[model samples]
Target: MAGVQDQLEIKFRLTDGSDIGPKSFPTAASVATLKETVLAQWPKEKENGPRTVKDVKLISAGRILENSRTIGECRSPLCDVPGGVTTMHVVVQPPSTEKDKKAAHLPKQNKCVCVIL
Candidate 1:
């Protein structure tokens, strides 16, 4: 077991305008586990939003964190993050609704078309 110093206090900034934690998690914890914690604590709402891990992206220091990496592997040792409290940004990518899908496939008008007299 690691000592208290090894534990990292992390806060999440969710896309739904929700902020979760300043919670302590072992630095050894995998990014996948971190995502799970965020998803669990994510606010439940009627509005459509990211419903699975695949729909969400967690970014730290301008880099999207990979699920396979451990906090310690990304932080200490590798030294990506500093000691003490840290905040990460979460992006929710909800699957597009059918209406949006239809619009995307529609042909876009060319803005620079020349009129033939």
Candidate 2:
């Protein structure tokens, strides 16, 4: 058998429902770089949101992506709709840890968490 290696186009959709086309880069491009590219293309108004790329997290195929890692199993909903203001459907997840629960101020400590991706 032969090994097949090819490049894939990664597209990022902002929280404002704006789509950034796939950029041609090696699959090894870091998540941080991808974020930077996405932010550059994002509308000015949307960039003023409370959260920036540093505060936001990226996940693909059930695994949290690291800043140094490349895109794999890429999926949509990378950027979350802050404060439930957008028409886009989102899933909301409860706090997962005691600290998170305390911060969110949930009445219970051990409740199952819901994660909106």
Candidate 3:
């Protein structure tokens, strides 16, 4: 038991209908860090793929995993196979930025109030 490894292997179900390998990582790996690895392995040709970590969300068991959660803590939500391999779904969202805050043009009109003396 001294040298036993609690390695967790997971596969990512990309939005593009592609699958990533059952990559191995320590059970202690944070969800935040795992996103980076997924980003690295993401296909460059994925036009709608995430451009940054903030643009991606990792979900398991119909819940979005927080950045602070350890991979071990998330194991329960996933379906573990005989080999302990699990799969997670990826959701890509557009990053929130000033671009989204642009104001829309409104038609200019003036109204005058009439008072009868």
Model 1 lDDT-worst window of ten: 75-84
Q: Is candidate 1 or 2 superior in TM-score?
A: 1
lDDT of 2 by residue, 1-117 (tens): 111133445555445556557455454567777666655565565534323566545444445566776653342345422222111111112326588757777565686898999
| Alpha carbon lDDT of each predicted model | 0.78, 0.48, 0.80
For residue 41, model 2's alpha carbon misses the true position, in angstroms, by: 1.7
Better of 1 and 2 by lDDT: 1
For every candidate in turn, the CA RMSD to the true structure comes to 3.9, 12.3, 6.6
Compared with the true structure, what per-residue lDDT tens digits does model 1 show for residues 1-117? 348767888888876566889799887898888888887887676255567777778888778899999887766334334456777888877777899999999999878978899
Top-TM-score candidate index:
3
Sorted by TM-score (best first), the order is 3, 1, 2
Clashing pairs in 3: none
Of models 2 and 3, which has the larger lDDT?
3
Q: Which stretches of candidate 1 lie over 4 Å from their true place?
A: 76-83, 96-117
> After TM-score superposition, what is the CA distance of residue 78 in candidate 2 from its true location, in Å?
18
Clashes of each: 0, 4, 0
